[model samples]
Target: MSHAPHSPLPVGHYAYDEVDRTFLKQRVAQFRDQVERRISGALTEEEFKPLRLMNGLYLQLHAYMLRVAIPYGILNSGQMRALAQIAQRYDRDYGHFTTRQNIQFNWIRLEDTPDILALLAHADMHAIQTSGNCIRNVTADQFAGAAADEVLDPRVHAEILRQWSTLHPEFTFLPRKFKIAISGSPQDRVAARFHDIGLMARNGENGRPVFEVYVGGGLGRTPIVGVKLRDDLPEEDLIAYLEAILRVYNEFGRRDNIYKARIKILVQALGVDEFRDRVNAEFVAMDRARYRLDEGIVAAIRARFGVPDFDPAGQAAEKLAQQRKADRAFDFWVRTNTHAHKQPGYVSVTISCKPAGGIPGDVTSSQMNLLADLADQLSFGELRITHLQNVVLGHVRQDKLYGLWQTLEQNGLGTANVGFITDIVACPGLDYCALANARSIPIAQKLSERFASPDLQREIGPMRLNISGCINACGHHHAGHIGILGVDKRGEEAFQITLGGAADQDTVSIGQIIGAAMSEDETVDAIARIIDTYLARRTAGEQFIETCRRLGTAPFKDAAYATA
Candidate 1:
């Protein structure tokens, strides 16, 4: 069957040129042939496995899984609608949004993936490099262009990196999977410091956009915060500098042991200074002009991301105030789920996918359609998927928020608990994943149900609670303020708790294990006890992390290990 070309350009973001379209079409055709060969027994399972994985097809516990890359987490209404259609037509009528800012269809058939990929190509999307030992999807701040405090739009740079890393010959089959994240704002919602490489935008001496580069930060069996490789790097040299770092890692990273294959382990073994020196030496030997980025290319990419038509003098404060006065729930949602926008009278809206007793990031096909409609009506036909497994409508007018919230509430999408305890991050553990040691959704559900009260969550203040089913740390448990890692002990599910971890831009830290493992039932009580201890010992205005720091883990340890 011939694969016909769809639209050459994406709906709202950067338009894909002919080269991009040709690449995706050719990739799909090649994978289709691979699938046919595997099914026909011309290729062995061992041989086909790597090819399938390289194309984002996975053999799960029951069936095959397909992960579609949402580059930079940016999505338009057309793309969202296409995803909804895929969920409805191909698999179950739901898709799980992952912490890596991608979506996974758990029940995808091996025979259906090529067709699914063909559908995605129509939206200028793909699944390339989403799996296997290659550079995965490049993630960035969901609020990249819209945030009020952003120094620059990180998506421009993120898109550049995505193009550079796509099917890169040297790094395609690395020691292990690599991840990179970029953030434009000082407040890092993307958790950049927990990736293999992190880039934060900053203003240089000449007021041009520079980057604060960090290397060797990752989470899995070993969790480490990245060290600053350079305080300031010129924008033109970004690709070359990154090439240097990846080259050093590709050369020296451990290949014998799977667990020690990550770049973080190498950085730790060699020391950050030594690693930096090697990268600098390699960079010095390279031809700078050959790798240097042209300003015109940057300008062309920037042009594709057209500015939103915002009303500068629009008056919406009075309407918002009146709505807040009339409805307390609306007021609470506005306070928790909405954020300041770069444009006046506009705000970014975070729609909490995690409801009480619900799975963390699973959104139904109906909800997806609703989101697409809402995006078209209120959010400039654009939306973003966050690394925290939440959906964001980045350019909603303040006056339209109440109506949007009302519709969301009617459809069970408005939970009014962004950044709250109920807003938990979880992975598809034993329920769907083959790699999981235990179930994570149940634990997340229990926690959300226990802390269902908005008043209680607000009183407790901003806290991050992450759950991982195994040591792979897909849920980012190590970076959470309260990290819960599920493990298999003698074929029984047990949980280990860690405290004082953070993934913030200003204070990135890894949580320390508090004590022995607890049963799932006991784990819930332990968390309650820890929270009670924090409440009892906290000073005025102290958050959970601050209270923990002031009183230390001794108090929490005692509380957690008490009679229960």
Candidate 2:
């Protein structure tokens, strides 16, 4: 069952054909002209802002940032190398991966952006809809086609949604930005419940994917779990149903206030039941037949994704166990980093971008190329970007796992604290983002150093500690089990703690404010104390979230303010 190294066919299902390549070239040419116009003083900054934004270019505090879309977080090694090339040539020698499973080049220049887009075109990638008020890049489970618990592959429908929403004349200018997440796995890996439209898709009796839709779910100043708008919706009707929701939100949604423009606000104002009624009304009246997903189209899209060849009886479970007994570090890595795959011999590996003291999702240009090469050698030339600011080799075999680990360690990519306390998700914060009120990276660095012990991290078990620089919740603090939100207090940076939020299928909830804002030092101390308190109180090996759910925030709050 031995496979050739870097085979001609990649395990990644989606391959861009002539049509997709043509579309990218055309888009790049258009952006190239726009960049020239802006450079030559023909287009004012104000005039060029929207055009640039439509292509995922942003004016950050220091410089222009370009966000390249990794649609559904799916891209191959070739695409990864393309990103590395962009980083090496156009901007800084590094790129920061975002919470949305996209990469951001923080030091981008306006003049070089057109060239960058043109280069991206060669790799069959683009930055379209990565910004603007449109339905932004659609995200699904990182282990979409491979998770052992998957009900059905959600990416087919994710790609379907991408096609349906991209430049759709109606949704191009909505009340505000909209986000949608889909999960085929019952375990919910992609944080489906926290999106604008969250869909939980399962296999139907007819083998077609059926979706349970959740609308108005978002986090920010107002963090709320989206409510289920519809149940058991056939795949064919998905686009139609979503269009209905968009139509309702676009028409009656608030146009006056920037803060109140999200679909969550609209859902709140109208109430969930009323909002559902409106969507249902639109669904019944619209041209449902025209919007229905055609079987031919679905088949074509699915065909683009080539299924990887897997060894049916090639698992080296005994060999892995023996190797685990030999090397403690490798064993520890295997314990936390690898996840179950649907294939017999393969396991999905999460490459921790969160080195103990390094930035959470920042990957160097060289590291990107190394990962690209590694993806080719071991993971069928495919890589997945996790929403938690990490990368995944979705189809790694159990036998070659040790070699992969060694190479990753040599290259400074082998931190094994995935899902542990040290794997904190944080935004760029005041360091790079103008919208940030406080420094998030420093706080994350402090926490990572404080809980650097592998034994301590294992003892704490799976923890979700998220930090946001402001009320915007870009770091998804509201969805973290132990959330720290930076707030302004008398011209000084302070943090507020929230407890008991969960972002999975088991329990979807927004974390509650446990206590008042505290200084940076106090915030880290509070998190440590909270973890220590959980160890004392948790009867079994219950995770931080489970403990938070069972024991309530009362105890954690006490520990947080125990000294204060």
Q: What lDDT is reached at residue 383 by model 1?
A: 85
The TM-score of predicted model 2 comes to: 0.97
Each candidate's lDDT (Cα)? Answer: 0.89, 0.88
Please give the clash total of every predicted structure, in order.
0, 3
Error of 2 at 563 (Å): 2.7
Q: Estimate each model's TM-score.
A: 0.97, 0.97
lDDT of 1 by residue, 64-143 (tens): 99999999999988899999999999989999999889999999988888999999998888888889888999999888
After superposition, candidate 2 runs with Cα above 4 Å error: 1-9, 205-208
lDDT of 2 by residue, 236-312 (tens): 89899999999999999898998999999999999999999999999999999998888887888877787776655
Model 2 gets an lDDT of: 0.88
Clashes of 1: 0
State the local distance difference test value for candidate 1. Answer: 0.89
Error of 1 at 553 (Å): 1.1
Clashing pairs in 2: 13-305, 13-306, 14-305
> Model 2 misses residue 20 by how many Å?
2.0
